[model samples]
Target: MDIRQLKYFVAIVDAGSLSKAAQKLYIAQPSLSQQMAALEDELETQLLLRSARGVKPTTAGHALYQRARAILRQMEQLRADVREDGGSESGMVAVGLPTTIAAVLAVPLFEHVRKHFPGIRLQIFESMSGYISEMLPDGRLDLAILFRDSETHGMSVIPAFDEELYVFGHAGLKLRKTATTCPLSALAGVPLVTPGTVNNLRLLIERTFLREEVELHIVGDIDSLPALMAIAHGGSACTILPASAMLHRAENARPPMRRIVAPDMSRPASVCWSHALPVSAAALAVRKAMVGLIGQLHADGRWPGITLRPPPDAATLEDTSGSV
Candidate 1:
C-alpha cells in the first residue's frame, strides 16, 4: 500500500521470517505483521504463505515482490535523479559482492565510494556469486564483483582480474616450493582443507577437481576462512587459496602457493551489471573507480598483482569508455 508496507514485505521475503524482518527493520514483530497483513488486505491478494520453517512467497506473492522491488528502486532513483542536475551524482548503488571479496574489500570500497561520490549511497550484499548473478538483471543489483560470468540474458560481464589460485597446507607436510605452479595433477593425492557446502567457491573447486579426475584428500570441511586458515596454520590440513588471499600465518605456509596453478585452474574475477537499465552517472563513476582500484591494488603487490584480463574473450571484459 505504501513504501513502509512494501519495505516490510520485502524485508520479510528477504529474511524469510516475520520476526527476523522485524528485527532487521527495528520494529516490533506485531507491528511488522500488521503492516504486511494490511498490505495484503489492501491488495486483496495473498502475498505470502506462513510456514513452520519460514515464509514462502505464494505465486501472487512472488509477482508482487518483484514489482515491489522495481517500484522501490524506481522511486528511490526518481528522487536521486531529480537531485542530480546540481552537478553531483547521487543515487543508491546496490553492490553484489562475492563472500571472500566482500570480506577483503568492503571497507575500502565504501571509503572510496564515499570519498568521491559522497551523494551516492552504497548498499552491499555479500552473497554467493550465483545469487548476485541472478539479481543483477532483476533491478536488485546495480553492479557486482564476482568470480564466474556465465552468460546471462540481459547482463554484460567484464572479466576484471586474474590471480593465481594457490594450494595451501599445514606446516608439517612435505610441501614443495614448486607446487605453486605445479600441474593440477600434483593435487591427485594431496590432502586439502576446503570450504563447506554453502561456499560457492568451494563447490566450484570440488566440481573442477572432480571433472579433472583429481582425487583430493579433503582433510576438513569448514565454513569460516579464518578457521580454515587456523587449521592450515596449525599444521592440521592443506588447503587452497588465491595467491592474493592473505592468510595470517601462525606458521609458514607452503610450498607457498606454487602448487595451485595450471592452465585451466586459474579463476578470473569479474565485474558485472545488468544491461537492463540505462547507466547512471553514479554507476559510471563507480565503474571507473573499480578499474582504477584494481590496477592500484595490483601495483601494491596485492593479490599477487593481478593483471586485468584482456578484452572480448571469455577471459576478458568488454572495456567500457566510461563516457556516459
Candidate 2:
C-alpha cells in the first residue's frame, strides 16, 4: 500500500525469513509480521507463504514484488533528479562495466567524474559482459556497457564501438611478426588461456572457431584478466581479447597483440539502459561523460584495435546523447 510496506515486503522475500528481514530492517519480528499482515489484509491477498524454512512469494506476491522494486527505484530517481547543489547536477548513478572495458574505463571514468561532476556520485559494477547485460533490464543498474547489440525489449541500446579480438602472447610464439593479422586456422593446436565458458567472450571465441572449422586448444580457463595476462606474459600460453586489455600493460613489457584474421571476428559494444524507467539527470550526465571519454580514447588511438561507432539516431537518442 505504501513504499514502507513495499520495502518490508521485498526485504522479507529477499531474506527469505521474517526474523532475518526484521533484523536487517532493525525492527522487531512481531512488528514486521504485523506490517506484512496489514499489507496482505489491505490487498485481500497473501503476499507471502510462510513455512518452517522461510517465506516465498506467491503469484500475486511475486507480481507486487516486481512492481514494488520498480516503483521504489523510480521514486529514488525522482528524488535524485530534483536534488541539485549550486546549480550543478547532484545524485547517485549506478553503471555497469564489462571486465575487459572496465580495465580501461574504470579509472578514467572515476577520475573524470571526480574532476568534473564532483557532486554526482558514481557506483561502478564490474563483471563479465553477460552479467552486465542481465542487470540492464532490472533497476539494479542505471546503465551498462554490453558487448553485443542484440535487441533487448524494454531497453534502449546505443552502439558504442567495435573492438577487434586479437591473439596476445609472448615473443616466443611461432606466429609471424611481420603481418598484423594471423589466419584463424593458425591458432589451431596452439595453447590458449581464456575465460571460462560462462563468459560471453569465451562463447564468442567458441562460436567463431565452430564457424571457421578450426579447433580451439584451450589450456587454461582463467576467469580473471590479470591472471590471463600473467599466464601470457610468463609464456605459459596465449590469450584472446580486445586490444584494450593489453593497452595499460604495454609500458610494463606486455606481450604482442596480433589481429585474428581469415574470417575476422569482432564484438560490438553498446550502452544500454531501461526504457521502462525514467532517466534521471545525473544518469544522463554520467552517460554523456562516458560517451565523451570513449570518443577521446578512440580519437587518441590509445584504445587500440577499436573503432568508435556512430551514435544511435535521434529517435533512440532519448534523454542523453551518450552512446555505448
In order, candidate lDDTs are 0.69, 0.80
lDDT of 2 by residue, 196-288 (tens): 888889999999998888988898888888888788877778899888787667566677678888888799888778764457666777877
Check candidate 2 and list the clashing pairs: 160-324
- The lDDT, on a scale of 0 to 1, for candidate 2 is 0.80
Q: How big is the positional error of residue 200 in model 2, measured in Å on the Cα after superposition?
A: 1.7
For every model shown, what is its TM-score relative to the native structure?
Answer: 0.80, 0.80
- Show where candidate 1 strays beyond 4 Å: 26-28, 41-45, 84-87, 127-140, 171-174, 177-180, 197-199, 247-256, 262-264, 275-279, 311-324
lDDT of 1 by residue, 29-112 (tens): 998888888888898989989989999789898878767776777677678888776435788888888766665566678889
lDDT of 2 at 234: 76
- Measured by lDDT, the strongest candidate is 2
For candidate 2, the clash count comes to 1
